[model samples]
Structures are given as structure tokens and as C-alpha cells.
Target: MTRLISALLLFALACASAAVARPNILIIVADDLGWADVGYHGSTIATPNIDRLCREGVELNRHYVSPVCTPTRIGLLTGRYWSRFGNTGPNNERCLPWETETLATALRSRGYDTCITGKWHLGSLPEWGPRQFGFTHSHGSLAGGVNPLNHFYKHGKYMKTWHRNDRLIEEEGHATDLIAREAIRYIRMERDGPFFVYVPFTAVHTPFLEEKRYLEAVKHIPDDRRFFAACLVHLDEKIGEIIKAVDDSGQRDNTLILFFSDNGGQNPSSDDSRRYPDTKPTSKFKGMNTPLRGWKVQTYEGGMRVPAFVNWPGTLKPGRSDALLSVTDWMPTLCALTGFKPTANLKWDGRNIWPMIRDPSKANRDRTLYCKGPGGRTRMVINDGWKLIEIKNGERFELYHLDDDPNEERDLFHSEPDEVDKMKRILARERKADDDARPDPKRKNPSPV
Candidate 1:
């Protein structure tokens, strides 16, 4: 009788432990995808899987990121402004200092198996790789971007291509498919406990390539754009596959999926034309920022704002929000959700949005947000609806009232000098706080190959 009681008590404890395990996290980051690229945002592109995530989850309408890829990635990983850590440029080996605490590192400490399956543009150095940053397994290109067919850098100067656990390997399949297959494989094999999978798809970026079936499906839309659209479809299917894997593994209820783009889409022609001339000179796919001006490389709304959605079976409510959240907020928000404390010594620029996720109506992010770009030449600050932009050189300080002029058509720098002054003062204070929050001085930059 006593032995039976002991066995029953042990079973109850096991069940309770399984029920309380930290939620599995899947972060799907699309490369250079515009806000309008997804069906939820009104793009003609067929993104049913992504659209479903937005429909059944919360869509962050005013989500923002850095003006370019690498900077935005740095912000996403550290939950701090990229500029604060001197990671303000593209293709810079000095960015993302080794000692910085990454999302992968934080989650891994909490007993989660962390894996990254695509683009690690933060740094190309040996120490900067995913393994050094707490990811147990990583497979993908290390540079900002890669060619689809040959899996080579555009310039052909960088020899670093595909890598799997520190060993270079030749990859034959299309990049997007390769990433998706690896992500699913990880999910299948690592379902014992909570796991974090970072799938940063190289699709819909430059040198757009797709499988023959996908390419043939969209052949009617003109070659270049058709191929681009096909890539989107391929990405959608892969997203569905990943979601299905989680559901089939009985981990769906405890899995939280976050989908977002690294930055706004590039003008396909600008990059696509250089490689493929016969392909109908790539044109804008009309991603709906409705009133935002500019594209990928600018500090305007369209460039910085991208689609952000979160879906966790029983946690987040389904809806849309314009709460002005940035990608940097994910780290702290995820930490809060999983009951993990962020590093006490580190200062993060992002605020926890978990409360907002639970109840969107109660969401209010009032902190000032900052963005810095290449050479630290481009900078911008957002506080509520007002924004201040400071470009390099002697360019005039530009101010915009985003609430009223969403397209940023009219400059209010001279019209509302007092408001601009107030914003400037606020920005000054915020900048001081950020500058003082630097990482350890002894930390060295990762070496680039």
C-alpha cells in the first residue's frame, strides 16, 4: 500500500512539472519583407500561413525596426537599441560584442534548447557565431545575405557560406526550403522540453529564387516579381509546416510563435536588376503603410515599420494593435512571459509588452525609441506621436507629427519649433541614458573572416 502511494505521488509530480514547463518559442524572421507583402496587410501576395497567424493572433500594426538588416537584428537579439552597442552599421565585424547577452543565451539559461536555423548577420567572427552566443545548434550563412543558386556571397570575395555546427557544408536545396527542413527536424527531435527555434528565412530578399513548382505556379506575374511572389508562397508553406509540426508534436498549446520581418522590403529592381535583366524590372509590390513614405534604407515610417504578430494558443488574445512597439521589446517581453529575469547588470531599452499582449486596450508604450544606421550617419527618435530625425553632416533636423502626417509628407520642423524643441530635449535625455549603458569595456569585437 505504501509503495502504491509513492508511485501515485511521483506520477502526479511528473504531470505537474510537464504542465508548468516553460513555453516553446519559435521566432520566424523574414528577410527584407515589406509590410504589404503579407495578405493580412493587403498585399496581393499569397501568404495564407502568415495571414492565419495574424488573424488568430495579435498583429502589431506600428511595429518598427532599424532602417536596415544587421542593425535591426542586433536590436532584436539584445533587446537593446543597436546603436547603444556601437552596432549602427551593416557588414561591420565590430558589431555585436561577444559579452552581450542574447535572447538565445537567456532562454538557454532557463533550460530551453536553443537553435538558430537561418541568417546570423549579427557578426561573422568565430566567437560571434550562434554557438558562442548560447545556441546549441546553428545552420545557415553568416553574412548579411547570400546568393540563392550557388549559395555564395554576391561579391564572391567572402568564402564563408553554409555552416553546420562549425563545419562548412555544401547545401544543394533552395535556401528557404533548406531552412524550413532543418527547423522542422529540430522541432521533431527536440520536443522533450521547452525549445526555442529562430528561423530567419533568407527568402524574399535579393537574388530571389524559388523551387520550379513555385516558380511555374506564379509564372504569369512577370518573371522577377513572379519569382519574388513564388518565394513568398514557398515561405508560407514552410511556415505552415513548422506550425503543423508543433501541433502534431502535442506542443502547440505550449508554443508561442512570433513572426516579424527584419526590415521593410528593398526596391527589388535596385538589387534584382543588377543580376537579372530579362526579368521585368522589379517594381514596388505596394506594401500598405498607407501613409508612410520612403523604403528600406530611409528613416521614414515605411522603412522602419514592418509586420509583427504573436500567437500562443492560450496566452495572447487575437486582435490588432498600434501600440508603437519595436523589435527590441521581444527579449524583455519573452523573459517576462517565461518568468526569467533579465541580466541585472545590463540596461535594456525595450519595455515589457506582455501586459499589452494580454490586453491590447491597456497597452501603452510611452518611452522614447532611437534608431541609428550606417556610419552612425542616420539617427531618429520617437516619443509618442512626435519624431526627430538627424542625418549625418549638416542636414537640417527634420521633425514629423506621425499621428497627423503618417506619410511624412510635410515637415513640421519650422512650423512647430517649440514642439521640436521639446522633442529634442527629451531625445537628449534618452540619448544620455543610453550612452551611459554600455557593455564591458574589455570586451573585444568578433573577428570577421
Candidate 2:
């Protein structure tokens, strides 16, 4: 009888230790946000709440992601470069194959109640929705970007992509408001264990239709930027509500809230009318990507690098880290920090970045980061301080010492022939590995590779 009591006590203590080790994770992804789009970054946009997170959180100064949404999300969820799937465009159909272990799935296996609120462009149809990818609850658009109020994808069969779980439903609120409401509802609910909530907002991303109140508030802003700034404000306010909910649930201390833009903001283009119909002043709707070269779709610093931060009050020290980081690093880093072991399946391209996060001055100097984007036919390879960008699939190329010229303004291709060859070789090797991992391009037809 004594032995039984002692065993029971030990089991209870072990459970307590496990509970203390696991922290609730809230990852917030903003769509099409720019480098200088927030208050802390000196933008004209008023984003006090997001600015507060930046001030109180550890700024991810050198964070990089895919130049677009679908691929960025694929990397974020799988911890693998999306190019591994032989694709870089918006994944209109089911992206992840069945039985794949996503970040949510891995965390779920480790006893987390996982939920996603907002955009889930990974798969457009209900058959391949978030539930299939391990989210216990999901509410939002399955499309890349939807009309803020209408909640419809481009007029087509997949037009009605907004859903709750696997079922489509008509909701009355604006997209941003609806997403925030669902997130708050999730956070306020009672839970015995850690929760993983991924809030991927489609704000500031599309047709540029602003809510009446938000539009009125930002009336001082000029032209098309008015709607953009209003959208940003709405996004910031919603984020504040989610953070407040976490605080109300008494999970503030143990909750790690990470915020980052999925990619750089869109720039003015000739085809803007076809892409965003409701953009009021479409003439020059280029978002504020000041000081960073290029915009969405290019492999430049502006297209991939973004404003990012992680906040965990007392748990993580708030500061800035210029360490080389990518969306792929999140899964490994989160697993390491929260004591979760993902089921061994596919090998990961990302490594744990907790060390860099802990020591701001420390960097993954030896690491190589590779990216391929469809817009500019952009292919990039970076090792140490050297970066090589092969535009239009090597039709044209540029090499730069990124450590010195963070902006790819000065092309050093002719000056450093050896460095160019080195990076090209590295990109080739990584590309081959990724292509090998992907399904044969000839076999699939829906989303042509």
C-alpha cells in the first residue's frame, strides 16, 4: 500500500514537471505586411498594439520567409522549405500529403489542443482543410486572400472558402473581426494543458476594403494608403484582443506569442486591376517597403525579410537579434523550447534557433539558406555573409556580400566570380534534394509545377 502511494506521488510530480515545461504557443502571421509597416519601425501607420509587442518582445531582425503566402505557410507548418514539394505558388489545392506531421500535429501528439484562426491557404477545398492537418478547430478562409466582408475567393467554385472546421458557413462579421472573435473565444475557454493557436491574418492583403470605422479613423492618411493603414490598424487591434484574452486566461507568463509578416507587401504593378478589384486608388498602391529593395515575389531583402518579434514576458528576455533565421527554424526551435519531440518522419531543413534567440549577438554563421520564388523566377542561396540571387532561373544573376550591403543594391558578380560559383553550386545541390523529395511534376495536374 505504501509502495502504491509513493508511485502515485511520483507520477503526479512527473506530470507537474511536464506541465511546467510546456508553454502555450501563439503564432500570429500577418499577410503582405512590409518592413516599415509598424509603429516601432517608424512607419506612418498606427500600430500601437503590434508596436507594443515589438517593444516588449525580442525582435527577429533578420527573419526570412518565402516571398509569398502559401509557400511560407508550408515552411512554417512543416519546418521544411516549401520548394521541397516542387511548388512555390499559392497552394490552391491540398498542399500537404496525408499522414504528414505538421507543427500542429507534432504539438498535438505532445498533448496540445491545437487551433487555427484565419487564413489557411495551404489547401483551398474543404476536403483538405486544417482539420486534416491536425488543427482540432479551424475558422477562416481556406483561400489565399478573400474579400474582407464578402469572404469569397475569386468568383469560382472555390469562391466560398470561408469555413468553420470542414463545413462552409456564412458569418456576419468582417473577416478580421470574425477571426479575432474566434481566437478570443478559443483562448477564453478553460483548458488543463498547453494550447497551440496559429492566427494567420489575411489583413492588409487584398482588395483593400476597410471597415467603416477603421477607414474613418485613418482618414488623415492619403489616397490608397488610407485603406492599407486602416487594415493594419484593425489587424493590430485584433492582435491586442487576442493578447488580452491570453492575459485574462492567466496564461500570459507561460504563453509565447510570435508575430511576423508572411512576406513583404505588394508593390504597384500593371496587373493590379486583375489582382485586387476593390483597391480604390490602384495607381500607386505600393506598400511601405522603404529602405529594402524590391517587393513581393522577388528574392530581394524586401520580399523575404520581414518585421518579426516573439514575446514571452518573463520567460524570454526582450531584445533584438540579427541572427540569420527562417520560418523553417520555428518548428525545431518551438519543439526544443517546449519539450516536444516530433514523430520521426521526413528530415527537416531547419535547425533549432533557441541558442541564437537566447544570445542576441550569436549567429548561425555557417548556415546556408535557400529560396525559390515564382514571381521573379527568383532563386537564392546564402552562406555566411555571401548571397547569390539568380533571377529568371539564372537568365540574370547578382552576387552580394549581404553582411555589408544588406540591400542587394550593389551587384558584385563580376568582382567575385569564385563566390558566385560557390553559391550557385550550393543552390544546385539543395534544389536537387528538394526536387527529389517532391512528387514528379508530370504526375500532378491541378497546380502545375
Candidate 3:
């Protein structure tokens, strides 16, 4: 009996040690947030909470993502380029194969409790929701940004996109508040093992409808940017709330918190207020990606390169890393960080960047990055600091050595024909694998590659 008791105690200790080794991953993604939107980035908008995280964590100065929401999300979850799935734009159809291995699936397989509590735009319908992609629990818009109060996607069948665990439901409070609340609740919940919480806030996206208090908080900003500022302030506070939940749960040091925007913020555009119900805004919407070349949906630095950071108290040191990275790296990096070894080839396009996060000096290595925009027209590839943007798939090509001119003002295509030719070869090689899962009009769902 004494021997059996000793064996049980040893088992308990082993379990505790394993739990300690597996850190809780909390990825907080802001929708349509610009590179200059956060306080640490020198934006006028007050993002005290985001600033605190950037200051305390490893600020990723050159992190890249797709130019749009759907592509970025797909790249993040799958650790592969969205174009590989034939997705270069915002998609409402089911993008992934039925058997795709996602970040959530990989983590969950390792006994991590996975949950996504915000926009899951990979598929708009309930049948093609986050749970289908391996999330154990899901809440918030199944589509893109919804009506703030009404919780509708747009004027269509998937408009009523609000749900919890893929079952459509309705709630009252603002989306930013609801998402943060759910994330915090998940963080504070009593669970057996480590938790992976993805809080993708639909804040500062579109149809800016912030509460009076939040609006009043940023009243000093111009009218064009006032609403966005208000929404950002609200988002910043909610992010702080979620972080505080982790601290309160005594899991701050045990949690790896990653914060980044889905894409670069857009310039002012006509407010498509008619798409949603009860929205009164008819003026232009505005977002700033100051000092960067382009806005959202373009292949330029401002569009793909976004604000990002990783905060893990005591584990990751606070500093800035200008290493060229992509949102696709999240899956491989996080999985590697949590000690997950894939049984098979997951076909990951992303490389494990944890070593870079651990020691910044080790980050500077030659790597190639690819980005394909909507409609298969615009494509870009970055190799050894040479950035190439193919407009209309080669009707015109713009080349910029980012190491020399990060703003992309000078076009070196004519002067550096060899570089352009090399980049074009890279683009062709990458594009060959695209459109593998594009939607078929005759069928309900496209076949997976």
C-alpha cells in the first residue's frame, strides 16, 4: 500500500511538471488595426494597454500578414499561405478541407483547451465554423465584422452570424466588450490543462458605432478618425481586461500572450452603412498606416506588415525585433513553443520563429516571404530584402530593395532586371500551388487539396 501511494504521488508530480512545461497561449488579434494605431507606434489614439504590452513584450516591428482579413486568419490558423487554399480575399465559403490540421487542432491534440472568441471569417456559416476547424469552443461572428448592436454580418443569409459554439445566438453588449468578456471568462475558468484562447476583436473594423463614453474619450481627434479612435480606445481597455484576467488567475507568467492586427488599417472610404441595420454613418471611414507605403488590401509594407508583439512574463524578454516575419509563423512557432511535434507533414509554409523570440540576435537569417492578394491579380515576394510586387500578375512589376528603401518609393525593376527575374520565378513557383481549394459553383463545398 505504501508503494502504491508513492507511485500515485510520483504520477501527480509528473502531471504537474508537464502542465508547467505547456504554457497557456493567448493570441489577441485586432481587426483592421493600423501599424500607427497603437500608442507604442506613436499614434495619437490612446492604447495604454496595447502600449504596455508592446513595451513589456518583444515588439515585432516587421511582422507581416495577408492584405485582407480572411487570408490573414487562414495563414494564422493553418500556418500556410491563404493562396494555397485559393483564398486571396475575404471569403464566406468554407476555405479549409475537412481534415486540415490547424493550430487549434495541434494544440488540442497536446491536451490544450482551445477556444476562439471573436471573428472566424474562414467560413461564414455555422456548418463551416471554427469548431469544424478544431476549436473546442467558439463565440462571436462566424463571418466578418457584424453590426455592433444587432450582431448581424451583412444584409444576407449569413447576416445573423453571431453564435456560441457554432450555434447562432443573440446577445446585447458591444462586440469588443463581449469578446473580451468571453476571453477573460475562458482565461479564469478552471480547466485541467493549458488553454489556448484566441480573442480576435472586431473592433475598429467598420460601421464604427462606439458607445458615447468611448466616443467622448477620443473626442479630440478629427471627425474622420474620431469614431475609429473611440473604437480603438474601447478595444485597448478590453485587451487590458483580458490580460488582467490572466494575471488575476495567477497564469500571467505561465501564459504566452501574442497581440497583432489582422491587416493594416485602410485609408478613408465611403462608409457602406447601408449593409448593416440602423447604422447612421454616411461619412468616409479613416485609418492610418503612417510612414508605410500602402493601406489594407495592397502588397505594400503598410498593408501586410502590421504591429505585433509576444508577451510572456519571465519567459520572453522585453525588446523590439525587426526580423522579417509573417502571421503564418504563429502556428509553427506556438506549436514548437508548446512542445508539439507533428506526426506527419502538415504542409506548413511557416518556420518556427521561437528561437528568434528567445534570442533576437539569432533572428537575422535569409528567408523568403510570399503574399497574394484578391482575384489573383496582385502578388508579392520578399527574398533577401528584395521586395517585388507584381501588379496584374506581371503587366507591371515594382521592385524595391526594402533594406535600402523600406517605403517603396523607388522602382528598381528596370535597373535590377535580374532581381526582378529571380523574384518572378519565386512568384511563379509559389503561385503553382494556389487555387487548390477554390469554391466550385456547382458544388456546395470545394474539395480540399
Candidate 4:
């Protein structure tokens, strides 16, 4: 009888240990946030909460994503490059197959409760939302960035994109506030297992609408950038709220929180607000990648390399690293960290970067990173420290050693014929894998960039 009691106690303790070992994962993604947008990155925008996390976490100074939102999200969730799905730009169609295994699904299989409360742009319809891809609970815009107050996407059948779980529901609040509210609610919920909370805020994205209170906070900024600054302030505050919720829940020590932007900032453009209901007349929407070349749509350092960091109270020490990491790496890294073993090969283009994140001293050199721009007009490959930008299948090429010219200002293609040949071969190899999943006969050289 005593032996039986001892065995039962040992089993209970083992179960408890397993639960504690698997930390709760919280990933917060900002839409269209730029490299120079965060307070730590020398932006004038007040991001106290984001800065605090950076100060308390490991900053990924060289982290990369796709040049656009949809591809970045696809890479993040699937642990593979968006080009694998033949996606180079944002699309309204379903991006994933029904049998796809996502970060949420992998974590859920390990007894973690997965929830996402913000932009689910991978698929616009309710049937194709986060739940279909393994999220147990999902809320916020199913489409891309929406009008801040009205919570509507661009004028179309998918305009009403807000939802909970698998159904679209009407809500009455600012989009940022609503998303944070749902995330905070989920964090505060009573549960038996660890949770995976993905909060992809739709702040600072488009239409440039912001609350007056946040606007007042950034009153010192110029008129052209005041609303954008206000959006940053609002986003920062909500991030603080969600972090506080985790702290209040006594899960701060047992939760790992990651924050990053989907892609780079956009230049002043009214293209996103076309045909939207009751929108103000076309005005400049401020976007800044400052000191980095290119905007949101190009595969330059400015477009793909946005702000990113990881925070866990006693786990990840505060520091900055220039390790070459991609957005797709999060799935494999987080799954490995939380003990979620994949049953089969997930065909991830990204490597597990936890080693580099845990210790900034460990550099990720010799890893190749590839990016294909919209319509396949431009392609970039970074191997070692050299970067090659090929336009329309070598019709025009720009090469730079990022170790020296991180801004990509110097064109070394004509100077180094040998390096250009080597990079072209590498780029060609990477391109061969593109469009294999969904073959596009028009994947050939797109229009000139």
C-alpha cells in the first residue's frame, strides 16, 4: 500500500514538472512597424512598454521577415518561406492547405492552449481563419489592416473582418483596444495547461486613424507624423497591458513573450484607403525606416528587417544581437523551447535560433537568407555577409557586402565579377524551390522594379 501511494505521488510530481517546463508563449506582432519606429531604435515615438521589454529582453537587431504582411505571417505560422506557397504579396485567398501544421497546432498537440487575438491575414473568410489552422480561439480582423475605429477592411465582400473563433462578430471599440482586451481576457482566464497567446496588433498600419488621447501624447511631433506617433503610443500601451496581465496572472516567470513587426514601414501613400466608407480625403501616411534603404514593398534591409525581441523574466537576459534570424524561425524555436516535437519533417526554411537568442555572443554566420519581392520582380539573397539583389533574372543586379554597407548603397556587382557569379548561382538555386507547391506559369521574370 505504501509503495502504491509513493508511485502515485511520483507520477503527480512528474506531471507538474512537465507542466512547469512548458512555458506559456506569447507572440506580439505589429503591422507595418518600421526599423526606426521603436523607442530603443532611436525613434521619437514613445514606446515605453516596448522599450521596457527590449531593456528586459534580448533584442534581435538583425532579424528579417518578408517585405509584406501576408508572407511574413505565413512564414511565422508555418515555419517556411512564403515563396513555398507561391505568395510574394498579400492575397485574399486561402494561403494554407487543410492539412497544414502550424505553430499553434504543434503547440496545441503538446497540451498547450493556443489563442490568437489580432490580424489573421493568412485567410480572410471565417472558414479560413486561425481556428482552421490550429488556433483554439481567435479574434480580430481576418483580413489585413482595417480602419481603426470602424474595424472594417477595404470596401469589398470581406470588409467586415472582425471575429471570435470561427465567426465574424460586430464589436464596438477601437481595434487596438478590442484586440488587447481579448488577449488580456485570455491571459487572465483559468486554465489547466500552458497557453500560446498570439497578439498581432493592427496598429500603425493604414488609414492613419488614432485616438485623441494618444494623439495628445505625441503632440510635439509634426502634423504629418502626429497620427503615426499616436498609433505607436497606443500600441505600446496595449502591449504593457497584456504584459501586465501575464504578470498579474503569476505567469510572468513561466511565460515567454516575443515582439516584432510584420514588415517595414510604408511611405506616404493613400493606396490602402481607396473606396473605404466615410474615410477622410487622401493624405500622407507617415512611414519611417530611417537610415535603412527601401520601403515596405521591397526586399531591402529596411523592408524585411524590422524590430524584434524576446522576453522571459529570468530566462532571456537583456542584450542586443545582430544574429541573422528570420520570421519563420519562431515556429521551430518556440516549439523546441516548449517541448513540442513534430511527428514529421515540417520542411521549415528557418532554423531554430534559440541558441543565438539565449546567448548574443553566439553569431549565426554561414546561414543563407532569401527574399523574393512582389510579383517576383526582385529577389535578394544574403549568404555570409554578402547580399545580392537581382532584378528580373539578372537583367540588373545590385551587390553589397552587408558587413560594410548595411544600407545597400554601394553597388559592387560591376566591381566583383567573381562574387556576382557565385551569388547568382546561389540565388538561382533558391529560386528553383519557389512556386513548387502552387505552380504559377507566370512565375517567370515579373515587370521591372
- lDDT (Cα atoms) of all candidates against the true structure: 0.76, 0.83, 0.86, 0.86
**lDDT for predicted candidate 3 compared with the true structure:** 0.86
Q: What lDDT score is found at residue 268 in candidate 4?
A: 71
Model 1 regions more than 4 Å off: 1-21, 92-94, 219-224, 272-291, 433-449
Off by over 4 Å in 4: 1-20, 281-285, 439-449
Query: Which is the better candidate, 2 or 4, if ranked by lDDT?
Result: 4
Predicted candidate 1 versus true structure: per-residue lDDT over 62-126, tens digit per residue = 88998788878878888888777766556635355566688888888888999999888765644
With a 3 Å backbone cut-off (N, CA, C), the pairs that clash in candidate 3 are none
Residue clash pairs of candidate 2: none
lDDT string for model 2 (1-449, tens) is 99999999999999878544888899999998999888888887789899898888899999999988998999999889988877687868777766667899888877899999999998788877898888999999988788777787776678888899968999987889999999999988888888999999988786666668988877778875677788888999999999999999888998999999999978766224344334234225645677889888878899999999999898678799988899999988887777776656567888899888777778778999999887438789889899898887778889989899987789999999899888989989887867535544234334221
What's model 4's lDDT at 309? 91
Off by over 4 Å in 2: 1-20, 270-286, 439-449
Write down the TM-score of every candidate: 0.88, 0.91, 0.93, 0.92
Q: Candidate 3: lDDT of 66?
A: 90
| Worst-scoring 10-residue span by lDDT in model 2 | 440-449
Q: State the TM-score for model 1.
A: 0.88
- Candidate 3, residue 443: Cα displacement in angstroms equals 7.9
Local accuracy of candidate 4 as per-residue lDDT tens digits, 1-449: 99999999999999866643789899999988999988888988889999999999999989999989899998999888899888999887788776678998899888989999999888798877888788989999999888878888888898889899869898899999999999999999999999999999998787667767988999888887787788888889999999999999999998998999999989776355665666663336566898999889888899999999998888778899888999989998888877777888888888889889889989877899999988898999999899999898668999999999999899899999999899889998998887656634333322211
Q: How large is the C-alpha RMSD of every model relative to the true structure?
A: 4.6, 4.1, 4.0, 5.4
Ranking by TM-score: 3, 4, 2, 1
The residue-by-residue lDDT of candidate 3 on 315-368, one tens digit each, is 889988878898999999888877788888877889989888977666554888
